[model samples]
Target: MSSMKKRMIKGMVRWSVLPADCILNSCIINIYKEGDYIPPHIDHHDFVRPFCIFMSKGNIIFGKEIYFVGLSEFRGSVTIPLPVGSVLILKGNGADLAKHYIPRVPWHKVLVTLRRMDHSKIPYGFQSDLELEELRLYEL
Candidate 1:
């Protein structure tokens, strides 16, 4: 994970909104299996600082119906495909604004991988077998 942190610090990522006096705080590597998907959710917590996601495998399919305030809605959901070596950096605030989810209808399955940096450290990987409870929320 430290190696990944170093890579991110050296990588060039444009932020949608930049904060004052920001630093490379932390990183988490999320690997999702096939048919695994995240439901509609937001990372609007106060402690979650500006973060970025480097896609390792598969693609993140955003829901068309679900939306967050002050964020752009995808036209019938967008497929963010990433090859093995490619990377996708979401500007901290804008990335936070996007409401991410996997729709039950049509039964689409996608892996929305992320490497988030915050003021504090968060546990890496899925915390539970239940899809809805996979992402554990903690105060950072």
Candidate 2:
């Protein structure tokens, strides 16, 4: 495994944001330029609860019902400023009921999202990573 990933997993487990046994087999990298915004929506159920690690400064808005003001803008119950390298773990009502979105970012931003795919939802022809399969925070 990459040293960076190792460090991140360690930090997450140490902070109790993620349990030691959580196996993250899927990853998505999102890069947003200035003026870019993401619409509010819940993550597909194909994967388990996902967590996002911010690579740049930005704000994420979350609410049970997200209202759009216009393209690139929105209104939500709360707006939270996420610092660089901050990790946001989504679960329960926050992950399944509430929708989340990013307002137009003032500058470039990058986010790394990690999740464990549901066993039955994994696409055919996909090969599992043995290393990641056995990875645990306690073993790091």
Candidate 3:
């Protein structure tokens, strides 16, 4: 599918859950090629909550590509083998507070991929219009 079409789909997901006062801020859907991986890093954005949904899976090694380096760091790194239909719910602090990356494993290095299903596509009456913009400003 085209990137824009994909983006629109992602946007629909985002808008569906957005609060009435929030704006349909930022939505991203990423695809990682085989042998490709995202480096360990933290999100440098201002968002109340940041959530991710695994749309598809292609040999993934979760939690192996992260190193906590702050007060909120977890005791140890987590290596979860995420399967299709799995949902990863993360708060802004949880996602941004710690550093994470795709680990380099001997077996394929695990291609990590997921889509952001934001909350901004609900019909009227689901939430207040004012809250929509407020909610969208932060990570969904």
CA lDDT of every candidate:
0.44, 0.77, 0.43
Candidate 2 residue-wise lDDT at 98: 94
In terms of lDDT, which candidate is stronger, 1 or 3?
1
Candidate 3's displacement at residue 108, Å, is: 11
Number of the top-ranking candidate, with TM-score as the measure: 2
Candidate 3 residues lying further than 4 Å off, grouped into runs, are 1-24, 58-76, 104-140
* TM-score for candidate 2: 0.85
Q: What is the C-alpha RMSD of each candidate to the true structure, in Å?
A: 11.7, 2.5, 10.2
lDDT of 1: 0.44
Tens-digit lDDT string for candidate 2 (1-140):
46566567666765667875666667778998888888998988887775545557788899999887876678999998988867788888889999999788888888888877898888889876665555455444
Q: Write the per-residue lDDT of candidate 3 for residues 94-127, one digit (tens) a residue.
A: 5656555443333332222222324454445553
**CA-RMSD of model 2:** 2.5
Better of 1 and 2 by lDDT: 2
Q: Which stretches of candidate 2 lie over 4 Å from their true place?
A: 1-3, 137-140
Candidate 1 on 46-86: residue-level lDDT in tens?
A: 33545545544455555435644323323335666656555
| Per-candidate TM-score against the hidden true structure | 0.48, 0.85, 0.44
